[model samples]
Target: MLLTLIYLIASVTFIVGLKMLSNPATARNGNLIAAGGMTIAILGTIFLYEEDGQKLGNYGWIFGGIAVGTLIGFLAAKKVKMTAMPEMVSLFNGMGGACAMLISIVEFDHLFNKDSGVNFEWTAYPPLSALTSDSFFISALPMGQLLIILLGLIIGTVSFTGSMIAWGKLNGKVKDFSFKNQQVLNILMLVLIVAAASYLLWYCNQVGVKINVLTGMDNTNLPTESFFTNVKIIFYGLFVLSILYGVFFVLPIGGADMPVVISLLNSFTGVAAACGGFLYDNKVMLTGGILVGAAGTLLTILMCKAMNRSLANVLIGSFGGNKATGGGGAGKDQGTYKEISITDTAVVMAYANKVFIVPGYGLAVAQAQHVCHELEKLLESKGVEVKYAIHPVAGRMPGHMNVLLAEADVPYEKLLEMEHANEEFSTTDVVLVLGANDVVNPAAKTDPSSPIYGMPILDVELAKNVIVNKRSMKPGYAGIENDLFFQPKTSMLFGDAKKVLQDLVGEIKNL
Candidate 1:
């Protein structure tokens, strides 16, 4: 009854937390609520062992693992710099995949040894009993269970390795879009695994008997060694196949589509988890898997919408890989840049009736959120209207901009979505673009040849005057030029985002 109630509370919190996340205003509170619920669930699960003789098998080891994991998590969070945030997320996510893979392997070993009729003599401890006779024992060689276990190992390993590759790319350890001669190696691995699987299957078909032994006596029905061999082969084959598939699948994608890839990988993780739940007949695993799968799918859809692309197009075009060549020529013709001093730009902004600010990955790299907040405060004190324009898929992941802004204590109401801000851009007197490109590029709306042509952007070009703070005229992650910089109404202020903003704030004070 207590477990049931605890689960119910956790489930309700998860649902409510998701609902709260729908609005930027409630996102922080929602996250906290969800965290509280998870804490309760973990406590309830740990307490279950106290009631019965049932334990986690190794209590000291379990506690040690927990302690180490917690310390690592805390240190990583505290020590990881903002510039390395994407890599950190990838690393953490990879660890989750690794953990899941280990769990699936442990379960397989338990089932395999039990089916093989393995026995051991006991000394001081109670004599070992036959696990085969245990009611919880899934069929010794249940094909479905075997398949799920195989899938879990394959997907989990692929996710772990692939995510590490992503982290390398983000950290510049690997060049963006570089493909290695790994296809042949992967293919060879696949063939070897398949051959092993075939051999195991043939052996399994030859043996039709089941065996389980306990106390020097046959205990119950179980599959022979051939069955376990076949299961092992399947797992190995699938693991290799998944690794090859993941590498090739992501190899063609460009950095612009990374958000989609992240979401898709997250979905794969959930599916793997669901398979694990089926393997163990564990309800909590099932629930968590379903929730994660559904949420990840939904997030992928939103990311596509943010990019104004279809799921099919994203997959085939390899938008997240190296295949994306920026929509180039159109922006060059329309965008004409004029350099301006921070003082001049600040003067124009100070006298403006309304200002809209667009932030991007550059802001994250510069760690400029705090400075930006100060600028906003300065502008407000002068009675200048200020609003922030945020794209759904801006930065490296979903809600990235929102998270950055929230960290700086930006008011929730000050942040505006693309749609809402679009309607107001034309009425605004100034649009201050900080390290933004693709999200505000006019080429998406006008150039049919653009890879991101149909993507939704913050209509920053609609503002009467535009001020872009950038280190260079370099294209964004999409590798495309932004036409907004060339517009007659646009002016460039070249520098680091934080330095430029600080200078602008100083100038604004003088005005």
Candidate 2:
């Protein structure tokens, strides 16, 4: 009863925390609440959990593992730079997938080897001898139990390998890999996985049961040694196949779509975790997994919409690679770009009544959020209104720009999403783009051949004046030169984001 109550508390906290995450104001507190509830649940399980009239032991091992994990996690997060946050998220998510995969493997071993001189008295492994014939499969284990185990193993393995690949790609350790007919191979692998798993189920159902087809009668017996041998081979084979499939599944996806892929992989891990929860009949674990799965799936769909790409496109389209070509606009002439001096930019922004600043990946790369915020403050002091426009899919990961700006103590109200910012752009006096490129590029709407075409972008060109800060005239991650750079109303301010923002702050303070 106490464990049940603890589970209920943890479940409630998870729900509330997830809800709080929707709003930036309560996101921090909500995270803390959810973490606190998880701590309570862990303590309750470690101290009071019992099954089959036996309690948990090995306190030294359990606490030691937890301590090491806590220390590693703490140091990783504390020492990691803001720019590499996406890689860190991918790495941590991979760890969750690994945990689920390990759980499924351990549980499968216990289920199959319980009576073969391998006593698992420390665990709450259901006694095969005690299980009745009611609703039972003809196999050694229940059909539902076996299904959960296999699913957890396959999904967990896929998520682990896929997340690792994503981490590698984000950190520049791995590049996008694709070949001819990659999608066809991906589909074939999926079909093979389904067929193999289905055959295993059929084998388990008929391992020792001899059916007289002409007589239309069957005799069911216990599974034979041959069945165990075959099952082991098929199960392990399935595991390896899933790992390879995950590698291929993410290998062809372009860098531009990685945010969506990460969200999708996150959902896979959640589903795998939920399967483990089902295997263990743990309510808190089940609730947490379900919440994560649902939220991740929903967020993926929203991100897809924000990018103006379908989920299918992100998964199989192989859209944008990381090969940057700094030249004219995707084979078309964009003419020459005009440069703006620091003094001219400061004067334009200082005298303007309203200015909108759009942030992108370069801002994060340069770690200029603080100085950017400082420039905003200095401009606001001179009677100019400053607001930040955040593209949904901007930066390396989802919510990357928001987190960056938040770290610099920017007001939540001052940061506007693309949709809301677009409505105000036409009326604004000036739009200051900070290290942004493709997002403010007019090609997305005008040039159909552009890789980022049809994707939602901040309409910075609608403003009366436009000033973009970039280190070079290079194309963005989508590998297309921005048409906005060469526009008559646009002026480029070339420098590192941090240095430019510092210069702008100094210029605006004097103005």
TM per candidate comes to 0.81, 0.88
List the candidate 1 regions with Cα displacement exceeding 4 Å: 1-9, 23-29, 47-55, 78-86, 113-140, 180-234, 244-248, 316-336
After superposition, candidate 2 runs with Cα above 4 Å error: 114-137, 208-226, 321-329, 448-451, 506-511
Q: After superposition on all CA atoms, what RMSD does each candidate show versus the true structure?
A: 6.9, 4.6
**Per-residue CA lDDT of candidate 2, range 52-157, in tens?**
8789999999999999999999999999987888889888988999888998888877766677623222223346685554333233346677789989989999
How does residue 492 of candidate 1 score in lDDT?
Answer: 92
